[model samples]
Target: MSETQNFIILGGSGAGLGVAHSFLKHIEPELRKLGKKYHLYIIDSSSHFFWNTGSPRSVVSAALLPAEKLFAPIADGFKSYDSSLYTVIHGTAVSWDVGGRTVTVELANDQNTQTTLPYYALVLATGTRTPSPATSLHGDHTITKAAIEDLNKKFASAVSVIVSGGGPTGVEVAGEAGHFLNGSAGWFSSRPSNPKAKVTLVTNRDKLLPVLSKPRALTAEIYLNQVGVDVVYNVSVVSSTTDADGKTTVHLSNGEQWTADVYIPAWGITPNSSYAPADLKNDQGYIKTNHATLRAEAAGPRVYVAGDVGDYSRGGFHNLYATIPVIVANIKRDLLEAATSSDGSDSQPNEPDRLFTPNNSETQAVPIGPRGVGAVNGWGLPSFLIWLVKGRDYMIRNVSATVNGNMV
Candidate 1:
């Protein structure tokens, strides 16, 4: 209905889609019971929803599945919803006016016309921007696929492969390369001296998986080294130059230079909060939200944020999962109060906003090739369980179901 409240969602990746799915699964039912009507506008730069957790493995090993599987249409996630209430806009939000409750988005095309959309409530799920394999921020799936194909080709011919960043992404990428090039009966071991790709991992941290415990970190490095990945720690790549012949000379901060055929930056996080109000953001440009309520610390219209874009002390898929339900609950509460307040003659008392307490517990699974390592909370897990839980398909199948609106 034209009179219905417009609840706009920004971003369509893991955190964004999580909120969208929650709206359809939880918020819609409550609204129906209250005889309320609302519209969900999901605006994203990318038309397709990318499974970020599986991206690193997918780019390094495209043979695992089709490119289409890596990136699926965002609309497919809301197949069960009524088309009238769900609107998917593929564009970039360039400006916003919290005072006016309107956001201007620059459409993705040569024209680049700026279109303004007014909203009753807003959910900022834009998240952070990172290089491909960790995350694709450009929102162009075609370009991402093409880049992946090119990388695969380079991997095939590269003699020395350099992966910078020892985070989960870099660790996994190095592992995939090792497995692909030197697995059982692999080219590296098969030829033994044919000058196959020598995979090297460089990180500024003292150890891999810096967030994990010492035992888990050491185990991860041991596993990767077991698979033929040269793990270099306490060193970061300062700059790299690729020659005409495709040979890359990588200069490290330690004043050491190494030559490689392929270089991949699988680290770093750049927040995507340009469209957010400055007062609601932190020094790092990430939106500041109440730890319990997941509500933006603002005095104007009610605003909420989640995912990498939110300034949580620790960031990961685990944090996103913990905050999604809280955000949904708070939104539903606001909507209910607003609906009831409309019928009041003189005045309606405001209801207290629900606070969301995030669970600080952490869990990580990093698989290198067939065998991997992981930790749940502070306890270390076996390699078999790591592979079983995530290494099998990098949880792509499960994430796909989530994207498709399946219960799993």
Candidate 2:
């Protein structure tokens, strides 16, 4: 019998889940042809995978749609595969011994108990950690969904809403809140028509969606303005305090002050690479990778990385979509080479691992309410297409379909 190699993937979101599903549905068949056996273990602290790209809108519309739609069980994606071939561990990866090819994970059910996993290869797709509603990293979908639902209740009654950050998340939040108040008749009936009832967006940059093309940025600003969202540019939130009345006062770097009943900070995310070797990380703590191969720079060739945790020039769903295929290909190549080698011997250098060549460029789609705007490969997209593609339901329906086994 061939020795069964172990492949451990640490993450259950976009990149990690993408590779795992593709491997089971596509690559595993090829490996079976080579008469190689392996156990693929996917570990994540959360039992369910949160579709964070749609989180902004989901949080705002929690009352209209079921919170369950925002999360999908990680194990559900692997149901079609053989039980012995793949296992999903519900735990947080705390530490790793790269030299020994062992990883320590903190089990979600029992925090005090830890489990060590030995692997022939490891794929790091832990992604990033961000504030709730922007990216839920609570490791529990129920808690995250409940928190967002409570926040939506707060938003429903709030006279004023302030969202800090001009990036995609903030823009989406502002747009969704504004649209909910202006468009939702049932939600609007409760609140009095005070002009003060506003959705304010604060950003340090001069333009909304600064990383996007100028045309796209302008389009986004126009959409937000049309939806009654106040875009406050060139200002940063210095501090915030809540008063007895429950209204919070936000102090800005420009010496401006604003009071709002609801406040959300969508500033950014921190890369979830605490287990990564210091030498493999950049100043911002993102794992440095060989972009061509998606391999960790300082880690051995057996280790790879993808998604937001990777030190790619840009991090987004489109980038992840383009990157995961490369990661899967490289992992398959390495596995095939290992399978061809004789017992206890490394394969000759005749066949090298395939390099990941990215065919797609940086692409972003920022949905604002029923309208949308974005750029793909330096080309701007029309509002109708953006609306049809993402703004309609913020891709929630698509994610829900995948969870229902329709698109998976």
Candidate 3:
């Protein structure tokens, strides 16, 4: 390894950006003291970073602000420290050469250029991708970009739409689609009138937001019903097929068939780990890591995995809140080390004993439509105050200001 170590981070979403910010804050001073410069590079395929919280809202109204408005350009954001020390590449990592300590990345340009970056340390913060909806037996197709686009196109022309899946994403999609349908009449009043669209939400779970507490789940159900969405529960999708007229027919396990112009699958997401090495992954293909150290289980040293890509064995919601700080701490420790003293001192710091499990208070607040459902310890609370605090604006403006160095 060179005296000046290079850090290559994969994925440029919430986890990746959070890791970058944490690295700059935690490790820069130590590197400066050592008279060494640390180089940081981030690889992501998209030019713009999408706020996950804003995705559902964007799909509904197509009113999401531009990528520039959401995230600061990675290069510019790191330039103040040292432009040469940090670089952002628009590329997709096709494979990793673990033995050679290199990653092969395919650039997004037409030339189809490929480059291998050698890293002393690699941080895998790549988040999950939307699952393919076609093969989802549970009828979860509403979360992906393609599925959302298809739903919008169908809803614009059809009279009815059915959304399957009862999770946060599913409920959000169903509600948003319902709102879109209700507004389409006004949006196209001057144009040729289209038939009114109806939205039905189906879930195999007994109640909407089943992960939430009873009161909160009931509140969510009531709110969804108020918005003209038919909430059906305890039903499973046995099969789905499209007819000649382009309408989708869904067969229920209970022996019922319902046809709709558009059927949205909004099941859930699996971690994106195809780029990761097989030995480093768990049975589900999620990278396995030491939660306290954030080090890859199979990697001997100087390699870490963070964010949704890592399997903490606790839960799947390993994003900005839980994993980023640990990644930062581990990276800082690796990058800053004192020379061996004349007494032949051991270089590694005493491993700080820490618990890796999530606290009971660690809960995610999910917003259904404009209203928010605050979940604490996996218990949901029916409160519009939570929505006002974080949901109403979708935190886009705040994140934008933070990244772009501008007030929203």
Candidate 4:
């Protein structure tokens, strides 16, 4: 096989795994039949992978699979392959050179030794970074052990807690905090208490779960209220300060202030594009891609993008269900030298052509305490069942199984 067909994948999170799985499921068979040899290199900084969506539950129940359980050793998972066919490196990519087709990665322990891995094709699946205050205020920011420890300490002493932001992450944190304070009747004999630890969920939006429909939003509000969370709507925080007494004073834009023992900032996320190749990125620092094809719009053939870093009109929630299939098909076609055309297209397309088109099936599900509100394909389903399926279990088992290659 030519060196140009070899693949180097950056970021081994959901997106990275998705692309790798796609290649294995769709493209591997064709390559094996043709007796073609292709190298696949997977790189990530961390050895552990946590199910981020399940983090709220981790904070509340303190029940989480160990870091090793949540992730498969990258080397072990690919050990069967020849060294030339597949390799997994534990390092952080400092930057990429588009013109040279090289990626510079710094080893975890040996920061001084930087290695450049030249690739025929590159997949930029490095997801977004968590927001500033959230990432800065706490260590192990990516919903890992260290982050849960920080929250646990606050929960132990907090009399009142303030959760800023009304988005899915904020809502989940607020609801989970309430559950931690109130305790579970079925699971525990006594409820946990910080006595003064009241949870106040502050949202600038007029309603909770603004992305969901009115009915679902109302359902989430009801659930939160029932769990003893103080819902403050249409209020924005102007400034926050820590008093001499070690309490946090949050000044609201609506001319109100509240004191809390702990405050959690669950604001939105921004893409982490600083380490990526500049030429492959758009003005927003997100990778510019043919939404249909999932290939870099500027880079030539073989390179592809998936998950959060890729600019897709369908938004975050839908990208999981939509982009994976297209990426798989494209990779397979590229391996077989098949025509790079859509299913019904008459002519093969050039590099950087749109391979997939998105539909307006974007949906979001927010878990409020033990109940949840969801919009399926823009259709509202205000039910407590959504929470039962997602909120209660946090999908930890499913994620663990996937990382273990069980296909659960």
Q: Which one is best on lDDT?
A: 2
TM-scores vs. true structure, each candidate = 0.91, 0.90, 0.80, 0.83
* Cα-lDDT of candidate 4: 0.66
Worst 10 residues of 4 by lDDT: 132-141
Q: Give the lowest summed-lDDT range of ten residues in model 1.
A: 184-193
Q: Higher-lDDT candidate among 1 and 4?
A: 1
By TM-score, the best candidate is 1
- Give the alpha carbon lDDT tens digit for every residue of 1-408 in model 4: 422355788877666776775666557656766656567888777655445676555554344323322334555545444556667777788888887878898886688989898876678877776552223212122435665565666666676989888878888888777766764323332233332357889988888766677777776766666566777888887888987766789899889898887777666566656777677677778888887778884776677887787766334445565676677777666656532334622234355433666655537877777667787788775557676667656666666444434441
Give the clash total for candidate 2: 0
lDDT of 1 by residue, 1-408 (tens): 226777888998777788888887788777777777878898988788777677667666568644556778888778777888789988888888887989888887734588899888888889776765334656566777777777777877666788999999899888888767765334344322333568899999998887787778887776676566788888988888889987889899999999987788887878887887788789899888777777775725557887778876377666677777778777877776766666741233376666656555557879877878777786778889989988888777755676776631
The digit string of per-residue lDDT tens for model 2 on 254-368 reads: 8889889888888878888887778779999998888888888477757889788988737766666778767887777777777777764234335565666553553678888
State the TM-score for model 1: 0.91
lDDT of 2 at 42: 93
Candidate 4, pairs of clashing residues: 159-196, 159-197, 160-197, 292-355, 292-356, 293-355, 293-356
Question: Which residue segments of model 2 deviate by more than 4 Å?
Answer: 184-196, 241-246, 343-354, 357-362, 400-408
